[model samples]
Target chain A: MTVNELIEKCGFNAVSLPEPEREINGCYIGDLLSWVMGRAEADNVWITIMSNINIIAVATLADVCCIILAEGVTVDDEIVKLAGEKGVNILLSDKKTYETAVAVYEAI
Target chain B: MSESLTFHYDVDGEDFTSAGQASVQVKKNLRRLGIAPDIIRQVSIAMYEGEINMVIHAGGGEADVIVSEDKIDIILADHGPGIADIELAMQEGYSTAPDSVRSLGFGAGMGLPNMKRYMDEMTIDSTVGVGTTIKMTVYLNR
Candidate 1:
């Protein structure tokens, strides 16, 4: 399923969707920015508890289709603004990382 | 002909949130240079890991990315405390970063390993308490 479908069906909130319809070909769960950068395949839906501004750069650099922040972590205003500015899809989920990863996998 | 170009940036150590900015800019510059997407990805990922390491461990550093027809050269130099054990640090699950850094979703001992993973060639020059210099090359023609 597309990112938008994941948002719609999986109950994920699209906090800043620059690419709602982006195709998520895989799912990678990692909090280490560098680890994700090195391992996560392009167009993967990256799930993490990290809600820092650096995430935007990682998502953009890794070419991840979307960033799903699990555990309802909320970043500051500047980070959210930067997310929109960078044109990256940022989603929020109340579920834990494992649940979110499974949901994303099953959704797509 | 497009001659080789070089871009430099001073990574700020105080701001962990902005650690990857240099890598992001390098990625964009490489994209405009008409490099293949895969090549750009490798270069950016390796450099991004280097930039993060500079901030989290070395209190920031200087990054120079030289783009040429044959390769992309990334030189990261810092004056902060250097690696005490290169072989140990290169291990995939060994990290020296503080617990505070770990809370930020990094410091999982993957920085150096990731850098090497994404680059075609990598070398480390470091001295304890003096500084560290890492040079990585991604060959475009390889």
Candidate 2:
């Protein structure tokens, strides 16, 4: 399913939807940026609690379809702006990381 | 054969938030040069890891990317305290980064290993109290 479809089905708040139509092929759950960088496949929806700027670089480098900031972890306006500028899709979920993964699993 | 292209950037150690800027820029340059997506990903990831290591442990460094017809070379050099044990450092899950870096979602001790995992060849030259230099190459035909 595309990121837009997943967002609607999972009830996620769109933070940056530059590539809302980007397809989601899989899901990866991790908080360690380096580990996520190496393991997360392209087009995967990365679920994490980390909201630093490095997350933006990781998402871009990994070519992830979108990032779901789980556990209600919110980023500042600067991060959202960077995500938009870099063409990285981001969604915010009130659920925890596992729940976010399950939601993505069911939606995709 | 045509001449190789090189890109250079100085990593700013003061800002952890901007660690991977060079890798991001390198990714864009490779994309513009029509490098394959997979190759670009490898180069970007390897360089990104190295860049992060520089900022976290070495107080920043210099990074260079040399792109040629058959391969790409990435070199990272830093003047911070060098790794006393290269073997230990190469081992996965062995890192000397402080708690502050770990809290930022890094310092899982996978930087060098990840760099090796992505590059075709990796080498390190480090001296304690002096500096460290890492050179990695990724072949295009691979």
Candidate 3:
């Protein structure tokens, strides 16, 4: 699914979008960076509650399609800028992490 | 190419946030070299897990990546309390990391297993109270 579709389905707001056409290969929902690092596939959508710049770095390295910030978490502006520069999409939601994951899982 | 390309990185033990930087760079470098996407992802993910393990468990370490025509090899060396049981450590969900590390989204005990999973060959050498050295190789050819 496209990022926009995911946002609409999950009731999330697109905080930042590098492009509307980045393909979503799959979905990986995890807050553990190490676990996600090992399991996340390139072009996969990563859903998590963490809001650190390292997320951006990981997304860049893994070539993930986008990151959805669950649990209504906020990120540093630099992170948004970095995501834009790296061409990774970032979305935000007010739902709890588990709820967001369930929604995303169901949508996927 | 006759000459092998080598890259070395010194991982910081205390910074969980900054971990995996080297692996990211290596991934970019491999991509630039036109390596296969599958091979690149395997190498990058394996190295990234190792890097996080070094910072979380070993307090820091050194990583060396040697890129050759046929394969990519990664050597991770750290001077920390060595693993008492290599077999036990290899099990999934076994971790020695503190609660703080877990709160930061690590210490899942999947690092070594994932590394071994993606690499074609892997060797682990450790001495109690001494250190640990892991060598992993991923072949370029399918």
Candidate 4:
């Protein structure tokens, strides 16, 4: 699946720019930056409530396919712009973290 | 086996966001060396956990990675308050990190265990008031 497919399947409202085609593996659900830094794999969907730029750093380091900002959290515009620069797909969801994770899994 | 490459990093304790930079670099180095993705993940995760512990528990630390044909060895040394009880600290779900650290998505007490889990061999040396040093190795052929 792709990031666009995930957003469509979950019926998540796109609060930011849409994503281009990217590969999707599985989903990793966690907010612990260090844990996700180690646990998240390349081309995986990283689900978290963290909206910090460090989250973007981790996503870049882990090479995640897309980041799902769960719970409708708002973030600085710079993050989304940086994601575009880094070729990482960024999406936002109004659903809770767990529900978003489940939706991702079901979509996969 | 003799190491083909060595990388050393001085981890800054003040920057929570930069904690895993060393691990990220190491992962890239290993990937350029044509190491398998699984092996690179193991090395990166083990080293990243160590890096986080250094920033969270200790003020900061030093990390050294030696890469060779047979294995990769990571040494993380910190001058922060040492572990009081190794046994208890090793137990899952036991954490002493402050609330702030948890808010960053850590302090779940899984850092140490996850490091140990991903590495083939790990050793911890610490003195209560002195400091702590962790040495972890991931075998290339494993």
DockQ of 4: 0.45
| lDDT score of residue A74 within candidate 4 | 79
lDDT (tens digit, per residue) of candidate 3 on B24-121:
88988988989998888888888988888888778999999999989899999999898899999999899998998777677888889989988999
For candidate 3, the per-residue lDDT at A26 reads 80
Candidate 3 TM-score to native: 0.89
Candidate 1 lDDT by residue in tens digits, B1-142: 2588999999999998778889889988988988999888888888888888888888899999998778889999999899898999999989988999888778888888988988889999999989999999988866
Clashing pairs in 1: A1-A108
Which consecutive 10 residues in model 1 chain A have the weakest lDDT in total?
Answer: A72-81
DockQ of each: 0.78, 0.87, 0.61, 0.45
Fraction of true contacts retained by every candidate, in order, equals 0.82, 0.82, 0.62, 0.33
lDDT tens per residue, model 2, B59-126: 99999999999999999999999999999999999999999999999999999999999899999999
True contacts kept of 1: 0.82
| Number of the top-ranking candidate, with lDDT as the measure | 2
**Candidate 2 Cα outliers beyond 4 Å, as residue runs:** none
Q: After aligning candidate 2 to the native by TM-score, how far in Å is the CA of B99 from where it should be?
A: 0.7
**Which portions of model 1 show Cα errors greater than 4 Å?**
none
Provide i-RMS per model in Å. 1.2, 0.7, 1.9, 2.6
lDDT of 4 by residue, B1-142 (tens): 3546889999999998767778878888888988888888778777877888898889898999998889888999999999999989988778999998887777888888888888899999999989999999888876
Per-residue accuracy of model 3 over A8-102 as CA lDDT, tens digit each: 77678887898767777788888877678778888888889878777876777677888988877888888788778767799888888778777
User: What C-alpha lDDT do the candidate models reach, one value each?
Assistant: 0.88, 0.93, 0.85, 0.81
Please estimate how well model 4 matches the true structure, expressed as its whole-model Cα lDDT. Answer: 0.81
Model 1 residue B11 lDDT score? 95
State in Å the error of residue B39, model 2.
0.8
What order do you get sorting by DockQ, best first? 2, 1, 3, 4
